[model samples]
Target: MTQLFSDMFGTIIDNTPYMKAIGAYYAGASEDGITMAMPWREDLVGDPETRVIASGVVTALLDNCCGMAVWDRINAFKAVATLDLRIDYMRPALPGHELKVTAKCYKLTRSIGFVRAFAYETSVDDPVAAAQGAFIVTALKSDATGVKS
Candidate 1:
């Protein structure tokens, strides 16, 4: 990760109240992607009996992961918003296990970024959820980075 993205996206991740409340943190990141992990906590459970993580929490994780991946792909700090996101839940997250999600930007256009992500406790093959997302990139940061729209 470059300094600008690490500084900007890192700030966003560190400051998000929900992310903090859920105990979300970066597991790892690369120039093309990002990975995040959140421990299973009582308050985060969607079903107390099942001890499954809330779908909403998982959705937030996917969104944040996708957003961060896009920002890193852009290689600069800029205004970006989720244009669309599609998530398919494969199954309940493993009980009492921390869920990890990874996302990568696969395509970049002048105004948009396309990404894919998945959530799992152990392996991507047995995913808890998978996501395909697109984000709208504002022109503000592109000028500085020479990304012509």
Candidate 2:
């Protein structure tokens, strides 16, 4: 990842309260997006009987991954917020399995970015959930180094 993005997006993620609470971590990067992982934890379970990871956790994971992809596509850090997010839950995430998520920023205009993402455990073909979202891109007053110029 570029230093600017690392500073802008990475730092924000690192410091964000909810993201930190979820224990998601940066996994890798691709040409169009980035990936992250969330390990299964008892505290993340929504149903005690089923021991299944909460859907809300998956939602946060997808949103964060998609947000990261937006920055990756921009190749820099700038202010952006989710404009819309729609998630389709295919199945419950298996307990004790770390969920992996990848999101792609497929399109970007001056003020918006379109993203798609999915969550999987054992295989990408068998996704636990999928999401499509839009984010509002803002003109940030920062230079290449992610510092005001």
Candidate 3:
């Protein structure tokens, strides 16, 4: 199947308010999967002194990354919902370091897509968090862009 990540990619991803609010941006995509980045900002610090990013921000980053990976794998613009996302925090991210997240849609069936993602600053092996999630995919109408529900 021909992979599609542009037409519907910007329409849905660029408009995500949560992604924007936390300074998350689409880094790029490769044969491996989709990648996204979040900047470390003073406003995002969980503790004023430690300056570690809030945990919720990392969760959001990984979630969006997973969704995009599913879209890239399916090679179509379809409605996808996160059925479940389990993120295991390996360690707290380094202060003042930008967090990078990459996700791969390793398996896709007619109705479900499975993804595994890692959030890290330096190396994937030394990840700040690891997530494995399943997304429920649904067919779209003729337009193929809108989420039915």
Pairing residues by index, what is the TM-score of model 3?
0.87
Clashes of each: 0, 0, 0
Candidate 2 vs 3: which has more TM-score = 3
Model 1 Cα displacement at 128 (Å)? 0.5
Residue pairs with colliding backbones in model 1 are none
Output the worst ten-in-a-row residue range by lDDT, candidate 2: 140-149
State the weakest 10-residue window (summed lDDT) of model 1: 140-149
What is the total number of backbone clashes in candidate 3?
A: 0
- All candidates in order of lDDT, best leading: 3, 1, 2
Over 51-133, each residue of candidate 2 has an lDDT whose tens digit, in order, gives 99999999999988887888877877677788889999999999998999989999999978899998999667899999999
Instruction: Give the range where candidate 3 is weakest over 10 consecutive residues by summed lDDT.
Output: 140-149
Give all candidates' CA lDDT scores: 0.83, 0.82, 0.83
Question: What would the TM-scores of all predictions be?
Answer: 0.86, 0.86, 0.87
Write candidate 1's Cα lDDT for 1-149 as tens digits: 42556455555767888788789987778643688899888888899889888899999999988888887788786767888899999899987899999999999899889999999998888999999998888867354332211
Tens digits of per-residue lDDT, candidate 3, 41-94, equal 888888777888988889988988998898888877788888889999988889
State in Å the error of residue 6, model 2.
5.3
